[model samples]
Target: MIKLSGVIITFNEERNIEKCLQSLVNVVDEIVVVDSFSTDNTKRICLKYNVKFIEQKFLGYIEQKNFALGHASNNVIVSLDGDEALSEELQESIITLKSNWQFDGYYCNRFNNFCGQWIKHSDWYPNKKLRVFDKRFAEWKGINPHDEIVLKDHRKAGKLKGDILHWTYQSYSEFNAKTEYFSTIAAQAYFEKGKKAPFYKLIWNPFWAFFKAYFLRLGFLDGNNGYIISKETGKITYLKYKKLRKLYSNN
Candidate 1:
C-alpha cells in the first residue's frame, strides 16, 4: 500500500479541527496541520492528536496551501480543509486507492452542512473538488477564497464515491462573518487579475443566483435549509461585486 500524508491549512479552527482530524485518523500515515497563528485553542487541539502542528504566517489561501504541501512528508497527499471531514465510505475508498494508486488525483463530491441541515441542491451538492492528489502532478492555484488544485495534465484525475462532509457553519453568524471575509479576498483577487464584472452582473447576478439555486436547481426540495442557502448565495454574490466596485472606484 502507498503511504499517504494529510495536509491542512487552518486559522482559528478550534471547533472543527478535532472532528476533521478524527475522520482522517486511520487513512493517513502522517498528518500535518499548518496554522496561521490562531489566537484560539486550535493549536491545543491539534497537539492532542498525533498531528504535526506548525505555525506559519498567513499568506493568501493558495500560497498558504502550497506552503503546507511543501511540508508534507509524502507525495500522496490528501489535502483537506480544517472544516471538512471524510465520510466512512470515502475513507474506505481512499484506503483502497492507496493500495492501487491508479490516478494522479481523486476528486470527491463535498456535501455541505449549513445551519444544521445537509444541502443537496442549489449548486451545492456534488460540489466537486480535487482534494486527493499526487503532489508532483498538481499544485494549488487560483486566488483567495477560490483556490483549486491545478494538475499539470488532466489525465491524472479520478473520482471517489461518498461525500466529504463539510461542516460549513456552526451558526448563521459564523456564515455571515466568513462570507464578508471571503468576499473581500475574492474581490481583491479579481481586481488583481484585471477581471471586471459588468454593471448588469452587479444587479442581475444576484437575481439569477437566487433563481438558479432556488427554482432551477430544485432547492425548494430542501425546504427551509434550501431557502437559507439561496439567501446566503445571493448575499455572497452581492458582496463580491460590491467589493469589486469598490476596487474599481478606488483605482
Candidate 2:
C-alpha cells in the first residue's frame, strides 16, 4: 500500500485542532502540521499525536499550505484544514486508495457544520474540494482566503465517495466575525490585482449572491439556519466590494 502525508496549516487552532488530528491519524501515513506559532495549546496538543509539526510565520492561507506541502515526505498528499475532519466514509475511501491509487488527484464533497447543525444545501453542501492529490501534478492556487488545488496543465481529477467534514462555524457571531475578516483580505487582494469594484457590482452582486444561495441553490431547504446563512452570504459579497471601493476611493 502507498503512504499518504496529511498536510495542514494552523494558527491558534486550540479549540479545533485535536479533532482534526484525531480524524487524520488513522488515514494518513504521517500528519505534517505547519503552525503559525500559536501562543495557545495548539502545539502541545499536536505533539500528542505522531505528527511532524513545524512552526512558521503566519503566511497567507495559500502560501502556508504550500509550505506545509513542501515539508511532506511523501509525494502523494491528503490535505485538510485545522478545523476540518474526514468523515468515516472518507477515511475509508482514502485507505482504499492507498493500495489502489488512481487518478492524478481526487475530488470530495465537503459537509459543513454550522452552529451544530449540518447544512445540507446552499453553497456549503457538496462543497467540492480537490484535497487529495499527487503533489507533483497539482499545487495550491486561487485567491487569498479562497485557495483551491489546481492540477498543472489542465489535468483532470476523479471524485471520491465521501465528505470532508468541515466544522465551519460554531455560532453566527463567529461566522459574522470571520466574514468581516475575510471580506477585507479578499478586497485587498482585488485591490492589489487592480480589479475594480464598479457601482453596478456593488449594487447587484450582493443581491445575486443572496438570490443564488437562498433561492437558486435551495438554501431554504435548510430552514431558519438557511436564511441566516444566505443573508450573511450576501453580506460577504457586499462587504468585499464595499471595502474594495473604499480602497480605490482613498487611493
Q: Which number leads on TM-score? A: 2
Full-model lDDT for every candidate: 0.90, 0.92
Per-model TM against the reference: 0.96, 0.98
How much does candidate 2 score in TM-score?
A: 0.98
User: Model 1: per-residue lDDT, tens digit, 168-190?
Assistant: 88787888898898989999999
* Index of the highest-lDDT prediction: 2
Global Cα lDDT for candidate 1: 0.90
For candidate 2, list the clashing residue pairs, or say none: none
Per-residue accuracy of model 2 over 1-251 as CA lDDT, tens digit each: 78899999988889889989988899988999999999999999999999998999978888888888899999999999988988899999999998888788999999999999999998888889999999999889878889999999888789999899888788889999999999999999899889999899987999999999999999999999999999999999999999999999999
Residue 96 lDDT (model 1)? 93
For candidate 1, give the lDDT of residue 65: 95
Give the lDDT of residue 115 in candidate 2.
Answer: 94
